[model samples]
Target: MARVSQAHLDARRRQILDGARRCFTRNGFHATSMQDVFKETGLSSGAVYRYFRGKNELIRAVAEEAFDRMRLAFESAGREAPLRPLDEVIDGVLTRALEEQARRAGTDRPGAFAELILQVWSETLRDESLAATLHALYDRMRVMWVVVVRTYQDAGHLRADVPADHVVRVLMALIQGFIVQRAVFKDVGGELSSGLRALLSPEADPHYRG
Candidate 1:
């Protein structure tokens, strides 16, 4: 009998996710079929169905996987000793995210998670559950940033006149807007850190003590 241990089970789950990600990247969420994933994974119909009840379940898992990656990316950036000030740190983090996202670009079949994330963002508007899930992820990310911003406020480093919470909100909004804008229009091009600061505050430079 084939031994099904925890490692094996996890491997199967990752296999399905990897396969779905590739197929989703190639065909998009709306067009991809479960049969496509099965073909990609080399899993039997029954075997694939045993792990995922349906496509929705598979997509949700894929989304969770994507979110996990983004969360780690941001959190790790926050922990790194920044070479610049608070605002610069925020800018730099986004700079990295944009760089990574841009690297993820290329209509030439990037990966399933790329289009998957975009589709989820678009579909969240029509699907209440998906919207709620996306909102929760956003909230968590914002909260993490709030802590980072608060550090500057406490140090009397950030602008005293402006609410730290507002700065946090601005940072998050800039990240989201830049990602969406870049995805939709490939025109805005430059170093993301510099671009983000300029986009967030056209008149102000992040290097200046505020």
Candidate 2:
């Protein structure tokens, strides 16, 4: 019998993760079973178990994948050529995120991405290990956002009156609020995108005299 190649193994893992994502999205983490994941993937029990030992492990992997995607999006916003306007950077990030969500929606996974994130948040409340892991990831993300925000401040786009940490905290709160609202109330994408740009724009603040 031939052994599976590394590429094949990686592909199989992604397949399992995708199925797990859908299952958790449709049914909350506590309600989703390994059988549901197996059914979602259309894979044999043995194949599913080979990738994830149980639902807990599968959910953790799903959470990691979600945050990794978010991290990439945030990093991209900070990396435009010649430094675009702060509002434009924010719009770029929001547009990419919403586009990805729409791509999932096109596949009959409408709102599943955001739903899965809410599922993770609920799971974190009851799972100490998962909570710690996600806390660390959020901390790292906060640090990244600080860098992004400070970069803008240094570029004279954002006000220096607010500390980077404070600014990032408010931004993160707005983002989380938008995600929750978008998940529950469909069609808020346009409003949320516009709000993000407006909130981050320099014009939102009266010119600081200090």
Candidate 3:
């Protein structure tokens, strides 16, 4: 038997993941069959097993991919953004996530990290491992929020005595609350965004401008 190179193996794995995600999004987790992934990939069941042992394993892989992608999104945002104040950093990230989610709100993008997140939360009773992956991702995102908090603290925008880790927890909770509310309602107060901006803005804005 000819040995597959690492690059070749990685490419084939990516291909299988892509097809599996499409099927999951189209048919939903419960509805999508292993055969659906096989059909999507045009690979036999045995060949698919070579990449992923089962559908659950595939879901875990997809979850890992989703987290890695989101992390990349934040890293890209950090590089491209103008370094002005801390609030801009937070808004930049939240805006990206919100926009991406809004795009997938109604669709059957089961492969979407956001959709997978909801499914994992709803189905955790039956899928512990998937739920663990999601919990880990959420915890990692909190670290990003903590960095923003420390940035503001360093800029003298927030009280120096305030704890960065504590602030991150508060911010994460705030964002999560908004997401839950937005799911049920059409409009959340724009004032919330304006308030966040004000919180990060220099209090002596008028005097500093002069």
TM-score of every model versus the real structure:
0.79, 0.87, 0.72
Off by over 4 Å in 2: 101-110
Q: Write the per-residue lDDT of candidate 1 for residues 1-210, one digit (tens) a residue.
A: 977899989888878877887776667788989889889899998988989998888877777667766876777776643334654665555556545543443234222233456787887777787777778887888888777666655555555456667887877776666656555665544555666555444236556464
| Each prediction's number of clashing residue pairs | 1, 0, 1
lDDT-better candidate, 1 vs 3: 1
Please write out the lDDT profile of model 3 over residues 73-188, one tens digit for every residue. 76556453336554555556656665564343334321244445455456667888877877888788777656666665666666656688887777666665655554445355
Task: For candidate 1, give the lDDT of residue 115.
Answer: 42
Model 3: ten consecutive residues of lowest lDDT: 102-111
The residue ranges of model 3 lying beyond 4 angstroms of the native Cα positions read 75-82, 94-113, 177-195, 198-210
Residue-level error in angstroms, candidate 2, position 155:
1.7
Give the local distance difference test score of model 3: 0.66
Could you tell which candidate, 1 or 3, scores higher by TM-score? 1
Candidate 2 yields a Cα-based lDDT of 0.76
lDDT of 2 by residue, 95-130 (tens): 576557545423454455766677788888888988
1 versus 2: better TM-score goes to: 2
Give me the candidate number with maximum TM-score: 2
The TM-score of predicted model 3 comes to 0.72
Model 3: pairs clashing at backbone N, Cα or C within 3 Å: 25-110
